[model samples]
Target chain A: MMKSKHIPEEQLVDYLLGNIGEWDAKQIKAHLYHCKKCQYLLSDWQFLLSQDHKKFQPSQSMKDRIQHSINQMEGKSFKRRTVIGKPGLLFATIACVFLIFYSVHSYYQDINTRNYEIAENDEIPPETIQSAPHTQQIKVTPVSEFNQINGYVWVNRNRNEMLLEVDGLEELINQDYQLWIIYMDNSIDHEILPTQNGMTRMLFRDIDVDEFKKLKASVEPRGGSIEQTGPDTFIVEFQ
Target chain B: MSNDQENIQLLKDIAAGSRQAFDIFYEKYISFVYQIAFSIVHNHAEAEDICHDVFLEVYQKARQYSEEKGSIKAWLAVKTKSRSLDRLRKNKPLLIHRLENLSGSKKMEPGADLQFLHSLEKHLIVEALKAIPIEQREAIIRSYYNGETHNEIAMTMKKPLGSVKSLIRYGLNNLRKQKALMQWVGIDRGEKK
Candidate 1:
């Protein structure tokens, strides 16, 4: 039986260097495939040469700089997670949603009802807006500085009837609230009515809404005027 | 807690995004990591940059670290060495030939099973190198630290290629022997060869 011949230990370095001939390199590779001692020797050389002995001390300032960078990163990441992880943030979000919904609901209710209080026992007009078919609703939003006032005008073009409701105005002595209808042809028609306790509701017949361009309300003298003489309370436009 | 257990816990905390754990980790291993970087890069500013990158990477990739693979110190040392080498390669593209020879010649495991020594005991490695004869020592240092090919080393030393290879083999054998003796005697302090 032929015995396997191990490559000389020193020549293993030559094999690594690629300095050995092709045939010699092939023999070394084959011998190393079966030899543990030769493998350990090769590894020892690799490990030992790869090591460094010189010592160094990094400046304290460098350490501080890196720590500062890390702190900044941590702070930013914490802030990012605060929106999801912090209970206070959840409460703040809920509060913001509630405030927005409340504001929207109040505005809607005020626009729809115009704060017009109808006592339970108050008699409904024989031809009321609710019973009138094909009635178009118009919201009368108060002018600037008259935010406390609100009104609505409902027009039933088919029946030639209209209903006007106003509320939340400051009461004026010896004055009546008046409604003015401006026509598209620039002609104006006016009506005056007494308001008890800052509210008034009136119904009219023989109205043609197709001729109307705008509706405005204002405080006027006791009998009424050909033109407005007091501050405007609310203004609404008809499309 | 044992140092190993503490290090593992620090890694876990760092993975979980604990800045305090990172601070402790930086204090604990910064010196060791910096030493390895400086040894490979051989410049203060460059080494410091390497340390910064390594620490950031460790923070981000802490979850990838497993005690089953290796010690934390070894992981840090390997990271520093790889980063330093990348810097060295970028700075000196001409060294590619030597680097190729280096990679071809020494195919040790990615992170070898050898225990990673701390900075305090680094001088012992210097001592081990010193115990070897001067010719073998020169060949080994030129091949490893200077990134010189064996032929380049042979030309520089005015020695034959065979002699350079022999010197490297002998130098490594001697260094390993000296290291084993030191470990056995428990005399970790550096001493004159």
Candidate 2:
């Protein structure tokens, strides 16, 4: 199964609402950097959300204070531009450099703090479908009559994350269930499905689902196989 | 000139250190900035302080504004919202976390819960929000206003993560459809006239 190439509407909404995790936010930002369609959608959401608030007027004193600050800034900048010679210019340049460095440092610090907060307070459940519109849900059906194992794969291509859940997968003697992710370019990545009570639930991060073409499960040697050298119990192909 | 064009011109003038332009621009958008801050902080004095800080930043950073990025109103909204959230975070470190308790188990249909509804304005955006279910609206507002994440929202709403995501997704989709319908109706009315 393949999803729409565009970033899903729900994802744009998530990004706009700032509900997205750091990794997913980074992925969406990277995509929006090159994608004009998504940029427009994001802008639309921004406009709509911006207007959702009711109007409240500030006191005249607050307005006066802001105006006073603005006037002082304008005066200082004008004086600096007009009166600055070589020494003043050099000093101004140094101040500018320091400001830029401090801004950059503060930005990194903010990001780190936010990441820490998210990690500490917000923990996503493994079964949750992140960005459902971008997720490709594949039903891994039994390939043969003897295979009673049931499995499903959820690949969120945008976030490069996947969730693989299997049920009714009875244990095999002297064998392990190996999961294979077949790539679009004919490359393959395999992982041993560690099961607990006839159920396997695995969440993989940083695995690009766009590269995935097929998912297959096979019974392999006790340690798992280097390749797909076992009988295919379940298989799913992406188009 | 169009409102956006006029605002852009004022921004350009403010960037060039024109106090008159700055005043005009401030007069035009102060209510919007103040309102957004007030909504977030729910305290008039703090919101006023946030507004003062935001306008000062706008004055200093006007040169950095670009119409190619977005409209001036949207840019100011972003500035106001960012500053207001910063104020909220600074004043009460646990206020956002405490907001989770406010998300009660209220099962109300669209238009049934007017508690979250602000003063009804003429904007279709507000109307569109009014048309959405209460839970979804709360999720979106908490996420957007209170800066709560999906997981936080799920916990706050006493729902699963998937359900919270669905609520936001469906809520946004419904708003988008309502906006599109409003635009279509506006065009039809224009043609009729």
Candidate 3:
């Protein structure tokens, strides 16, 4: 069952590939404006599209020449035979092949240099796990199915702050474990924290302890799931 | 009746000596092949040349378009990519050979078949996609294959647009890095004592 409002993957693919008709394209465009899941699907599609539909364009004269060639072929009764006596075409192609290869090669080299410079200058923010716990903090323990669980949920009543820590688990790649505070009104997931050397800690701000009934942590897709709910890895009762 | 059938009929018209249909076809797919060629070749002039060459093939071989294999746009894309890569390997000078040998004996031509080149390029694409980080890979695939926009990617990834752009740039850079490695491997094997 399609529980979520996200457009199906099949329809998304067809829409992207321009296989769908005008009415469908309009409908999909409207859906896409509101659908983040379908939009994220584009990031994955960008490579093939970019690779397949490069940013390059043809010049006007080249277009005319191609059009001229088509005209000539049509004049020749559409024989499907190759054109001959156009040595200029061959030379033009040769010149293009050489110039483009040089430019693209050098252009990418320049980009790599720039990105390297950016990397060198870019500041690495302190890991969320390593952020210091605030002064006003309250402590609770998370219950995990795994027997080796060890972490404290420190909630600061004054600032509605919480610091979460867990040890003895491998830090996964392209996966995130997010903490959600389920209140009487609604549940909210806090920012993700990077784990290292089998340990993780994150400071959650704006926590309303009065309405907080339960806390949850779930391992989800890299950017976190579009849905607020997913498979829970750890749970804690605030009571 | 359908867009595909309409395209197939347009191709049939082009095959049967209709310059008007040829013009229509050219307008329909020029951007598809041109951008692909330019992106691969990275020169406007050269991309135009590839565009010319691509359409030239279509002009002569309109009859060969098959709905069974793929859409016309995809078919043109593969052709553009293979040609672009062939052009990318400028040191090889295969273009001259292809041009010189054009309309010559199929049995005697020294150049690799277009189909083989297409397969090779596809393989390279798959390998490059594999080598990139999953997050970056997913982003690229979504943008290109799924036809999602950068803003869409940003929203979906819960990332800023700048981050999304960076992911694509770095992902492509990684693909280039992997391309270099693959080329080195090819050279390594070629140079074995």
Candidate 4:
């Protein structure tokens, strides 16, 4: 009976480097396939080469910098903001946006309750969009376990028109998703109510994307509230 | 906490929302990853950013990793390479840190593994490596520190695979004898090796 050949160390290196002849490499491969010891040793060798000796850590400042970067990247999808700086613009804009939002929301509610009919004797007045229509696409991700609300947002600049597709959000019976837009400079924010059913097809011409650094959705009671927070809050930043 | 799987386990924990796991995993590999990034980008700040971006991708896209398909090193190496090449062009830098909140996780939560591994008798480990012969030291450093595979180490060292393996095995054995490391990392450190 022929003895199985053990692979030579030089041959193994040669094989790894593609320096061995074809026949020799094939023979080495055949032997290695049958050799469990070689495989284990090889894996250890692989481990050693790839191990971090804790040799050179990026400075602590570097770690903080990197961690901060991770935090920021993570920050984009879901973060809560306090009314930090000047409050005048933030409050005024939210009020105005919500006012328009209520009008549109009430208009839709009345239309639905009236069963989609515009009777000849109906007392409702015709509505007009005061601004030109503009649109921007926005996407969101889950902030935390509770704030898993995520979806698409659309803003029409100048037209004050906005639409939200609350893709992953599950509707709560008494809850609503309030949309908020915050400027990058922390100068102001605009808040509005989005149509439920994933904010689908509702045209809001008031909210502008470029005016905000981030878009937020906070779950609140029906009819909404001044506070932009609740059991769930979601955020996404403009790239 | 064993060979090969420790890193995979760390990543799995990160996916499972273990902030401590993420901390240790980065602690374990940041230097190695940074080395790869620096080697390519040749700029400290850029390399740091590249390293930051790579881990950020790993954490954010953890679900994308199929344990059945790939290893973390390969995933990170690829990400680092890709992100580094991206530096050749223009890309928005990601800022994850709150410059205001620079306090690190120096104070570990009780039962946090990072409590041990964070500092982990760092001086002893460095000293242990220094105690070994330069040949074994270089082999171990490349294999363990730089994360070179056996073949890569051999290519770099101009040595045979068997010799590279022997050098590392011996270096690791000598490193394990450091009582300070034994006390600090505990026995699992050697066992993992």
Candidate 5:
């Protein structure tokens, strides 16, 4: 159980250097939001960097080359604008608008459906998925017994996909849980969404599973699969 | 003109794809960018090339600039440093020689005054960083200069997620303390009053 209170020294360097990934960055961010000491420390480092900024000085030739490059790019852009023409531009604009509208509408609908499914799930909100306990196998229990949870399974209306994330999962290994988007009509096969490394939640969209009432997590071999040879590790049913 | 106001105007012109404004920006910050690059790369020619490439990237990606996220200076500094580091990593043999030369110089006396004010500033920063642990210094440098995210730092450093967070927290805390101390003992004589 790595308590959030103490961040390793190495990681602090990585975080300040912007070398950490999004998940870790988010975790650090959450920690920073709560930890004033860390926030002040970060601000101080930023100030140091700001002060260091004064030492930088470029040569005159470099300036000339950059100006030359910018000039060339501008010329190309001007040529492109002329080539595009009013009618061509108008058609392109219309096409872009139509595509954007279609994408947004479909995306919105998809998210709405995914959210509805997640909400109907009697299981805990996906956000509440904590860092799993470190073990060979993760026991997916209902949220009722765990500490406070913060998770979300909403659709990204723009992307037309359901984005699900369960933070605070106890770290576990060997046995990984696989997410299955069970569809209605029995015509569409169950879709297995990919899980991010060390992520406890799953998100999928563009799934027309309005009639599907359940989302299941099955224990699979390390790198999860479409096949569900293993038993259901966790089950969340839509109301 | 105030740096911030000039930056805002430059960014606006950049967003509009004005090459002249970009040239102005290049002129203004090229030296600063070069010095940082040279410090990391430790070579004049390569540093110049890196600076050129960084500015070119800025030109190409200017439209993507948004004031809400960060300032142009910060963005340029980050970009230049990352590119220089990447070059440094790729040319490890060269870096080894440079590092050897740097450590061998032994020109820096502990309490000696640096020639340029900028050198003094660098000395102070590096000294402050030294007061903290290496890991913290590494984290600060990577995050600030390399423009990497927290997870990337963890992966690169091969440390657990939690420890990385703490290192950054503690590192920053120590830095703040040093900064406060420095402010308290201002180099200026008037501060004695």
Candidate 6:
């Protein structure tokens, strides 16, 4: 008699068809990885299932009926934002709406400031500013010589936050973007700071007015604490 | 459109209250679902009703779709099978009881067992079975589709118990061999493969 621990060859067919339980499923998966014979069997079963496909085409009217039922269910459940509702739910909804509006408004204001700064200085040619979108809230002036670098850094004066946006970055495997804060005193090489949770968005907080003036942005790996600033991803001097 | 992706998008649209996409999606999978039900129920009218009910359940539960779990086809198959089984349980209690009582009936014939083997793709399974030797094919169809136990088959065929076991074992092995040969030749190469 074949040991019960040794799965029967016949069971593999049922296993692949999702007829087996957890323990048997695990055994089959483990066995398949090392056993070419079982793999071949699985491959044959898969072939059989594929051939069976054409023979099972569903009719058009039956499809219509199923879909109609789905539509009715969707209609009943979808609820648009309502003005009159429970107090707590209404308050939470309004707060969410307000926060979204505020974030978008603030973002536009920062972009506007960057544009204005670029126009007044004319230090950077107008071409660089043209690439950045225009907004009515704040003006941004691009520093002329700094535009040579591969990335753009814009400071938000109202929020006291500096935004470093990078483009044309070569994709890195197992590598990520990091940022550092350079102190004005020049006493410290640089205070390694975390910028951008995932290399996409960076936000620097509680800027010392003097230190903020001299800060530059750099890209580093994981926590970005390695060296002060090897080669700057972006450099900006606050006006 | 790729069928799976098209089905997924249709389901998504259905969830978003798009009646047209829902209709198209339903039309695509209904026959496939019906055939599965038919295979289990073995009656056209009842299988059609089961198929309709299965799709209705699918439609009502569109929002519950989780792509991470399994493919739309597998999910649909499972739901259809469960619903089909439920229908069978409810509608065929008397038939099942009768079969249980008649389980001990002597004079089992090979051809009678053959009647149980119906494939959604009838032409293909039939063709494949034809390629195998007659004894092996009969043994396989009896044990598999008919769910006949080895002892039952032995008693029915008036053959020695050991001979019946050998027939089933060797028959399955031969079928497996033929399947491997078909795969090697690249015949019926499709998704299941």
What lDDT does candidate 6 reach at residue A195?
A: 21
lDDT of 4 by residue, A187-212 (tens): 43323333322332233333444555
For residues A1-239, write the lDDT of model 1, one tens digit per residue. Answer: 00264444335544554556798677777777788766765664355335554455788887787776666554532332223446768888777668767865554343212111221111223437645679888888898778988778788888766677778877665465777777676566665543534566766555666767888888876445545778888998985
Which residue pairs collide in model 2, if any?
A: none
TM-scores for every candidate against the unseen true structure? 0.33, 0.34, 0.31, 0.31, 0.36, 0.31
DockQ of 5: 0.10
| lDDT of residue B45 for candidate 4 | 73
Deviation in Å, model 6, residue A15 alpha carbon: 8.9
Looking at candidate 3 chain A, the ten consecutive residues that score lowest on lDDT are A114-123
Best candidate, lDDT: 1
| CAPRI category for model 4 | incorrect
Q: Who is ahead in DockQ, 2 or 6? A: 2
Residue B19's lDDT within candidate 5 is 67
DockQ value of candidate 4: 0.07
Docking tier of model 6: it is incorrect
In model 6 chain B, which range of ten residues has the least summed lDDT?
A: B109-118
Off by more than 4 A, model 5? A1-57, A71-239, B1-3, B106-193
For candidate 2, the per-residue lDDT at A151 reads 75
lDDT of 1 by residue, B44-123 (tens): 78889888878876775576564543467655655565556545543432223323323333453343332222221243
Q: What tens-digit string does per-residue lDDT give for candidate 2 at B112-142?
A: 2222222111232444567889988898888
| Tens digit of per-residue lDDT, candidate 6, span A1-239 | 11223333335545666666698688778877777655664654453333333444445565555455444433432323445567779777788778767865554343212110101110122233223454112222223433433544555444444444444333333233434444444322232222221223333333443444444545544223333433454545544
At residue B104, candidate 6 shows an lDDT of 28
lDDT of 5 by residue, B23-109 (tens): 788778777677667656667788887887777666644544545334556556655655665455445344444444444443632
* Winning candidate number (DockQ): 2
Tens digits of per-residue lDDT for model 3 on B29-144? 88777766654444677778778767776765576565644577766766666556545443223332332233243454333234433443445456568877999998989887
How well is each residue in B67-113 modelled by candidate 6, as lDDT tens digits? 64356665666566555554543343322322332232324321222
Summing lDDT over every window of 10 consecutive residues in candidate 2 chain A, give the lowest-scoring window: A114-123
TM-score of 2: 0.34
Position A201, candidate 6: lDDT: 30
Q: Please tell me which model should have the higher DockQ, number 3 or number 5.
A: 3
Sequence-dependent TM-score of model 6 = 0.31
Worst 10 contiguous positions by lDDT, candidate 2 chain B? B113-122
- Any runs in candidate 2 off by more than 4 Å, and if so which? A1-56, A72-239, B93-101, B104-193
